[model samples]
Target: MITLKFKKFNIEAYKPGKSRVKKLRKVIKLSANESALGLSPKVKRLISNKKLILDKYPDGKSKDLRKAISKTYNCNFEKIICGAGSDEVIQMICQLFLNPKDEVVLPEYSFLMYRIYSKVVGAKVVFSKEINFKISIKEILKKVNKKTKIVFIANPNNPTGTYLTKKEVLELRKKLNKNILLVIDDAYAEYMKNSDYSSGLNLFKNKDNVFILRTFSKIFGLASLRVGWGYGSKKIIDRLNLIKPPFNVNRIAQLAAVEALKDKKFVNRSIKHNFFYANKIKKFLEKYNIFSNTVSANFLFLNFEKCRYSSNFFYQKLKSKGIILRSTKDGYHINNRLRLTIGSSKENLKFMNTVKGIFD
Candidate 1:
């Protein structure tokens, strides 16, 4: 047999969240933290453009897409870079900054992709403890040292759905070494109505080391398109540009995202619906004795820690009934918790009723 070799087991493969199961006739998918209101109708209208050329190469820089994102968000156009998703942009950061033995700091239960990409680039991952399901600034500061090169914080953290206030974030920045890159992954930024939260874009003006990673997949309802963009200082932008793959973001995704940004009405509708139904689900769950920690994103992290049954048991039970919710096992590292994305009003009601049937 030919010898099989890898980088001596450099990385464990990533486990993406579960997709909606399709066997059942009626299904309510609240697993992935995707928009309860799907893709913008304007984006949907663009899908039938039959005259567009299919075989042409996309603009390698994705200039128009970047300009649209910049104009919509009041950001510097030249400073933004697009990727297949923010996930690819994140991996590029790892490749550009991480040496064979450098260390990257993260929240104890932040996004799982950060850990996976760090390991692939031969970097060590350091996790800071969370306080009451929020990323604790004190714990994160304590984890820093001479070896630390990057600190990845996913604001309104996935699975947990809690966020760090802007004051706490700026304080963390003041204490950390300026040499270390501070990456803010703001995937669910638009869904948040928290008045004290900022997206770290303003932080980039005064701080040489701040970088913001954002995704069209979340609030834009373009999850299927896999388009995302990043903001940073010119030096960081240049480095990432040189390292990213050619035509990394496809033409279709770029076009869809550009349109997604133009339609603020649809985005506002999604935000309103998410806000309304998410709280509705929260109250319903509380009535049935299920509770969650404070959440500021599009999902809920149900506290099942006190229950006799495992999270897996609840996951499988819901799966059997055609209601899909996320078990914390997708590498978020928070045991005894289940994350359920807020679906449409009808979907949310069905999910809650299904749970009541099981437990009540």
Candidate 2:
């Protein structure tokens, strides 16, 4: 047999939140930060009523979806590139920008994809320490050097549920070297209602050094569809297009995402639902001495330091009751904490009831 040899890299694969527990047929999953309201009515109707041409390939450029994004966000049409998910866009950015020995910097407890993709492309991943679970711009700046290629940050940061204000983010850009690329993921931007907050696309629309990633997964309720788009300068978009997989986003996902953008009512309703239940859950958890960050995104970073039980103890208890919450030990390496995704009204009620049963 011919010897099989290929390049190998030391990288830990991503472990998603547990979706099942043994012997549980009906489980309430609050692990993944998915849409609380499920799919938009427009998306559901489009999928059911619109006849699709299965044999033919979708538009490689995703023209209609891009148009919808441009119209919805009021951004330049030529500067957008659609991807299978923001994860794919992150991967492409690593591929396009990184070489062996380059550096990528991000918060230590932020989204795992940024570090994972950077490592896959032979880049050195630098971790910036956060201040009390919030990303520190000073710490990020300390890690930057000539070898740094990109800096990735998720606002209303995943898993932590804490965000930086508009002034703070603007300061970060102003202080950083102009040549370094700052990749901002706005996955939960639609869920934000804070007056001091602003999405990356809105802040960096004209900046060539900044790239913004937007997803239809959170408030738009289209995680299963797997369609996301990136915004950057036209030159960068043109270069990215050269390497983007022809027809990266499938036809069904594209159509669904476009329709999802048009349904502002559904988005607003989801936001309202998230705000109500997030505060409700946060306040309820406090009775048991488990605290969380201020309500910013669609989830809460539940800290068990002052609680009667440990994070793992609560996780196992929930699992036994056919409920699931994200364990910070999975890839985050964070101790004494769990990421609690805001769920539907019924799911949230069940979670609180289960917590009471265990504590009472």
Candidate 3:
């Protein structure tokens, strides 16, 4: 048996939403931060057209889709690389950069994938302390040293939905050494309406050491397709390409993502719906004396401190009632908190009604 060295690392505990929902005949899943609005009709048609190409191998270079993304973002084609998902892109970055004992820095309460990938690459993972679920730049700066190879900042961070301001991002970028690779994971960038929110792509234009990561999973409603891309200087992109497997992304995913990018109407509608439903859920949570941060993303993090139930207990209770939510513990400490995905109006109402029953 070929055993991995880090076999002892405990897999992050995720709330068992899928298995729990299997037992419930009628389950409303609001756990994973997937877009509740379905994929665009154009993308569906593109997939239908590409079904015939399944017998052939995918384009090894993904040239056309790369061009599409490059054109959309107004960046050079040499600076972009597509992957199975943003997760795959992250893994590639780790493989290309991290040695056995190099250090990786990120916020304590951010996305779980950052930690998972760091360990997979045999890097020493150091977490900066979080303040109200947001990344504190001072804490991050304190943790940085000569050993730090890469630093990941998930803007509008997962679970918490907190983001860094443009000024904060620039300040951090300036303070970091030129050799350190700063990856700005903008997986939820599309949902942000604030003009001051740094997209990370701006850093790429100014600094050779910066890279911006994005995904089609959220705003484009193509989570199942798993299309992700990154933008950086040609040097960094070329380095990442060294470890990326040929044809890492599939044909259908490329086609769907290309079409989805062109579907501006669908993108607009999804953004509009996200803003509308997020406010509704916030108001509902407030009525129950439950407080949550006002996030500029498609998901809401509901802290259950006022309800007197542990997050795990509340998650189980919600699951039993046919409402699925994400629960975290151990490394991810939000006290008693549940991350809820904003869904369609009907789905949102169903989730709200189910929660109201629990509170009442």
Candidate 4:
């Protein structure tokens, strides 16, 4: 018998939100924070084009997509690096900066990919405490030391809809060690209409130590395409390009992302729709004593502590009705809470009706 030796990691694998229910052929899924409106009409048209060639490999550098992104965001094209998703960008950053025993700091509850990718590179994951489910700059500062290599944050953070103010985020960047890289994920930025908030790309476009991650998944309604891009100093982007997988993004995904960026009308409609529905749902949930954070992102972080029923009870009730929501217990470990993704008009109506039935 031959024995094989390999590196072992104790990291907990990432579990995506549930999408299926037993004994149901179809279900209204509000578990994942996906785009409620689905893909842009332009993208749908592009995908349906019969003239597109599939035999040739996609451009390794994703030049056309980068150009579209540059035009949309008013950023330098040379500084952008495309990826399969922002998840891939996180992994590359970890590989480039983390060494065995190096420390990476992030909020106690954030996008799980930050900690997962950091751990894969043999780095120690240090979680900074969040106050009232909001990322605390002071707590993060307290955790930073000479060993800290990178800090990751998602504005309008995931699982919890709380966000740091623009002033607060700027202050955090200023106070951090100059040598430490700050990676900010702006996955839900398009949905945010808060006056006090700003996307990472807008705030840190010229900063060398700050890298911003943007995705087509959330607001652009291209989750299945797996297209994301990173913006940083040209020096870092040039280096990242070296390790980036050749043809990481498929041809159709690149084309779709480009078309998605060009359709400003669609983006605006989605934003308006998200805000209107999120506010309506938030108020409705409050009547039942199911409190949530202020409206900032596309989803609401529902707290069931003050509600008449337990989170588990509500979850099971909705599941039996073929309505799925993300329970904070699975991986997030946030007891008595749920993360509700704002769905389409039909799906949201179904969810609310199902909840009403449960309560009545």
Candidate 5:
């Protein structure tokens, strides 16, 4: 037999939140951290109006969407570069900055994509230590070296739902080497209503090394359309635009994104729902002694490391009840943790009752 030869990079593929449960009639999927409210009806109505344009090639530059986003966020449009999602934009950044044996620094239990993308380009992945699920900038500084090319910080980090304040982030920038690129991934920024938390977008204005990433997938509820964009210095934005494929964002997605940005009412509703229900769920689980850290994002990360039941036990029990949640063991590298998305009011109530039954 002839030997088959293929060059495969050494890296773990990004594991998305678990979904697709079969044989469950009333399955409430709270695994992906997706918006329970979903896309606004106004977006659907606008998309429906644009049915005639589906036959044509989309605007390659995504000019309209960029303008809309810039207006909504009150940022400079020249610094904007859109992509299929934050994932693709991050891939582009890695390919541009990383070489074989180069290094990327990130916190432990952070978003997996940063590590996976860095490794895909043959770059070394370095993990910084965390304190009680919060990223320690001191630990991150210790990990950075001459080989480090990029630093990825997920504000309101996933699987933990904790955040660093603006002052803390600025201190990180001051301490890092000027040559290294700093990427701020703010996928959950919209869900957060706190004044103390900042997306670090201002860094893009003054710092040539800073890049701020935002997504329409989370608060805009356009996960299916996959619209993500980044803000950086003009030079960096120009480089990314050069490498970004023409028509990377489809016409439909672009249109929907513009309308989604304009619908302030919808965003307000989603924020309210997330806060009210996330707190409600956390309080309800208190009787079980299942505690979650204060979360600014749209999900609650319940720590079951010392609970009456193992994480796997609670997962299987909920799965059997037609309820689904995200476990952190396999993908997130955290044990005895479950991430529960703040679903609609009805779904949240159902979840509370269903979970309470397990203790009974």
Candidate 6:
């Protein structure tokens, strides 16, 4: 048998929860930050009509989808590139920009994909310290060096639900070297309606060194479809396109994403539901002395301070009750914090009631 010398990377320390629910058991899944409202009806219709085309190969150019995305954003078509998901785009970024000895900078409690992708390209990973589970700009600035090649920022950051204001981001960008690539991951941008907060697209337009990464996973409810795109200068996109595999995006995903983009009604409804239920959850938690920041995203970062059990213990308890939530401890070092995705009013109520019984 032929064997390669590449050893598997042990990056993400995922803790598998034991499932207590048996077949036919009803359970609420609020662990992953998925759009609980479900996918767009337009996507469903498109997928149904395109089922017969699966036998054929996908369009290598992804021209129509690119056009749709560019038209929606009012950007150049050449500057937009789609991938299987934003995760794939992250991997492609590492492959394109990182060298064996180059260093990558990210926040300590940020997304795990940044570190994983950096390591895949043999780049050294440097982490900035977390202040209340939020990335400190000062810490990031201190870590920057001549050897650093790329910096990743997740706005309305995952797991923490904390985001930097537009002013803060622009100030940070000013401090960084123009040579270093700054990636702003805006996976939850659609849910944010703050006037002070930008999706990083403004930075992309103003600075050639910056790029914005977006996803259909959260707001568009296309997580299962694996559709994501990135925007940057035409020069940067051209370089990325050189290494991107032909037909990187499949047919169904391209069609579904196009339809999902036009489903403004579904998008608005999902955002409204997220905003309403997130506030409800926050209010419910506040009565018990547990507090979270007022985030502009679909999820809430629940703190376990003054709770009877540790975060892991509480996680297990919640899991035993058929309630699943995302915990940040193993690789993230965010102890006593749980990231809860905002679900429907009923789902949110169920989660709140379950927590009330355990904590009260």
TM-score, cand. 5 vs. native: 0.97
Which scores higher on TM-score, 1 or 4?
4
* Consecutive 10-residue window with the lowest summed lDDT within model 2: 46-55
Ranking by lDDT: 4, 2, 5, 1, 6, 3
> Which has the higher TM-score value, candidate number 3 or candidate number 4?
4
lDDT of 2: 0.93
Sorting all predicted structures by TM-score, with the top scorer first, yields 4, 2, 5, 1, 6, 3
| lDDT string, candidate 4, 1-360, tens digits | 999997877788898989999999899889999999998999999999999889999999999999999998999999999999888888998998899999999999998999899989899999999999999999999999999999999998999999999999999999999999999899999898999999999999999999999999999999988989999999999899888999999999999999999999999999999999999999988889999999988899999999999999999999988989998887777999999999999999888888888888
User: Estimated TM-score per prediction?
Assistant: 0.95, 0.98, 0.93, 0.99, 0.97, 0.94
RMSD of 5: 1.4
CA lDDT, candidate 6, residue 145:
98
Report the C-alpha lDDT of model 5 over 1-360, residue by residue, as the tens digit: 999996567777666776766786668889888988988999989877834488789998899999998888888899899999887899889988899999999999899889988888889999999999999999999999999999999998997999998888999999999999999999998887778888777445557899988889999999988889988888998998888988899888898999999899999999998988888888888889888979599998888865898888999998888888998886677888898898888889889999889998
Per-residue lDDT of candidate 1, residues 97-148 (tens digit): 9997899999888888898889888899998998887889889989999999
lDDT against the true structure, each candidate: 0.85, 0.93, 0.83, 0.93, 0.88, 0.84
Q: What tens-digit string does per-residue lDDT give for candidate 6 at 1-360?
A: 997797655476544322235542877778779987989888887788834488789887678989988888777788888998898888888999998879999998778889988987789999999787777889999999999999999998987899999988998888898899999998998899888998787556656789889898899998888889888888888989999988899988988888888989999999889888888888888786667878579888878786556778878777788888877765667778887888877888888899889887
The per-candidate count of clashes, in order, stands at 0, 0, 0, 0, 0, 0
Task: Score residue 7 of candidate 5 by CA lDDT.
Answer: 58
What's model 1's lDDT at 216?
A: 91
On a 0 to 100 scale, what is the lDDT of residue 279 in model 2? 94
- Which stretches of candidate 4 lie above 4 Å from their native place? none
